[model samples]
Target: MAFGKSKNRRRQDAAQTKEAVKGAVRSHGPGLLKAILLTGLTCAVVWGGIELRRWALSSPTFLLKETTFSGLQRAAPGELLKLSGLTVGQNLWALDVEMLERTMAAHPWVRTVEVRRHFPSSVSVEVSEHVPAALAVLGDLYLVDEDGEPFKRLQPGDTLDLPLVTGMDREDYLADEAKTRERFRQALEVARAYAATEPTKRERLSEVRMAPEGLVLVLADGTEARLGEGDTDAKLQRLSRVREELRARGLSAGVIHLENRARPGWVAVKLSSPASERSGASQ
Candidate 1:
């Protein structure tokens, strides 16, 4: 009788376990199916994206048909195109824009460049070329831009009638590029100040010499105006007044010294006299 009762209890426990398992399956089966479906959908989307990219890369519809350029002054359009290595019928999507820009920027005149792809068939490149401001004599003459960067070497047939900047040593430039650029900038500032003040005689302005004492402006007529550091505009104004006065008096000055540290707001003039030297200070 004890053995039969034990066997009956074991059968009841097995029945209960089977029912619990069925209930658990009923609760979680739909969730498991939903999870599998979501996984499949994500995989399909990724595959579709990859295939689309592959098709676009190999498609003939994206071939380059035309290339255009703007803001080009000194750089030739054909040369720029050649430098970029972008030919018609090449795959537009295959072209690396950054690499093309770097290649085009290697041109001496290109200061800034922007390359863009117009969808389906075209590409455009916009460039900003350096504007020649003055000529810098650094061993070999170079064309200095408005920002005081010597961009291009002065080659034959490039005849630009601009102010000449002197006293910058090539060795100094080779040793410290930043210092040389700063010095060039200071000289350019003085030249620009003189041009603004003396517009009528702007063409007569020839050389801007970066002297150790300060800056010296030499005119085409061999007149020298010494301008010490600081108060550039005020000193230029005083020099302008002195120049008008001298012209009225029918006199020429060989050296107009406005840099007198001993007496501020006073100008000393040396007349262009071959016989005798005369010096006078004016308030």
Candidate 2:
């Protein structure tokens, strides 16, 4: 009877162990299967992306067939295309748009450039050229853009009848680029102020000389209009009235000093002849 009881106890223990194993498997089986499926999906996606990129780079279907250029004023399409190093037979997907843009931007006249590749067979380039605002005499005469950047040297046949900016040294520019550019911008501001105030006298504007004292506007007839910093528009207006008065009096001025910090509204005018005159601009 004792032997039979021990055998039955062993059988009961084995049966309990089997049930526990089955319960654990039932709890964890679905989660394990889901994890495996997710890993397979992620690997498949990565492989697909790699293959797609490889095919796009090597496929002839994406070969560039045509290139179009727009917003080209001073630059020729052929010239820019050559500079870009983009060929018709090259794969559009393989071409670096940023590199092409950088290369094209190296051209002196290009202020901004955008290069885009159209799907399957074409590319387009858009460029914005710099507008010459004034000529900066920095050792070599350079074309100053509207933003006051001296972009290109004045080449032969580049006939721009703009105001000449003097007293900007190239050595000084190299030493402190920002300060020189600020000076250039200030001179440009004076020119614009003069133009806005006296549009009819635009043609009379010849040179903008940067004197140690301030900015001096040298007219076509060799008259100097001294304009110091600040209140540019007001000073230009005063100058316009003074010029009209002089014209009415059938006289021409040699030097018209409108920038008197001591006596703010007073203008001193020296006649082109032997006689010199000082007058109040406020009147």
Candidate 3:
């Protein structure tokens, strides 16, 4: 009987230990499942981000479709577009903006180029063209800009009614920009002064020829005015006074020398042909 009780007791202990292990698993199973699901979600998010990036980089939808242009006045849009060498279907990522800018720079009328990409759809180009300040005669007529840059040769179709600036070779102007620009500035200054006159008076100034001594202003009536270097404003003031006096006297001159530094109050005028009277005036 004692041996029988001992075996039964061992059986009871083994059964109790099995029940305890089942209870522990029941308590921890939900927490372990939650931890595994969270880990899997993080992995899926990382994988999705990577795939999206790859798709965007290789997608055909991110192509150059439309091209818009601005700040283009004198430059032809078709010509500038050709200069850029851009096509509608080019991949935006592979577009070489710097090369396009360099190509645009090669255009004679283009002063500056700006190229931009509109993501997923289009491209834009802004071109600043060289603006003509005067017509310079350099073997042939050319459009000279404010910065002393002569950009384009004058075509027969171009307008002919602009102030003429002469006396410098095109190659010489291009070779020495600094020196050429200073000379150009002086000539431009003379034009500005003349342009300030009354509309009818200003229209009479047809040419501002650069001279070894200074400037020679030629009128439409074949009258010439000698404007020596410096004191441009003072000289113009004196010229105005002389013009009033001449108009009062009903006199037209072939040439008028106004570089009257010695007698700042006086002007010398030579009469036109078929007239014998040479005259002088005091302001």
TM-score of each: 0.89, 0.88, 0.76
Report model 2's TM-score to 2 decimal places: 0.88
lDDT of 3 by residue, 1-283 (tens): 9999999999999999999888887999889899999999999999998898778767999877899989987778788778878888888877899998899878888999999989987988988888888888888998888876778899987775777888788787768978887887788878788667625754367778888878888877787888877777777777766666667988777888877677765678886755655656665
Of the two candidates 2 and 3, the one with more favorable TM-score, higher being better, is 2
- After superposition, the stretches of candidate 1 with alpha carbons farther than 4 Å from their true spots are 1-31, 201-203
Point out where model 3 deviates above 4 Å: 1-57
TM for candidate 3 is 0.76
RMSD value for candidate 1: 2.4
lDDT of 2 at 6: 100
Estimate every model's Cα lDDT from 0 to 1: 0.89, 0.89, 0.80
Candidate 3 weakest ten by summed lDDT: 195-204
The number of residue pairs in model 3 that clash at the backbone is: 0
Off by over 4 Å in 2: 1-20, 201-203, 275-282
Which pairs in model 2 have colliding backbones? none
Candidate 1, residue 248: lDDT: 100
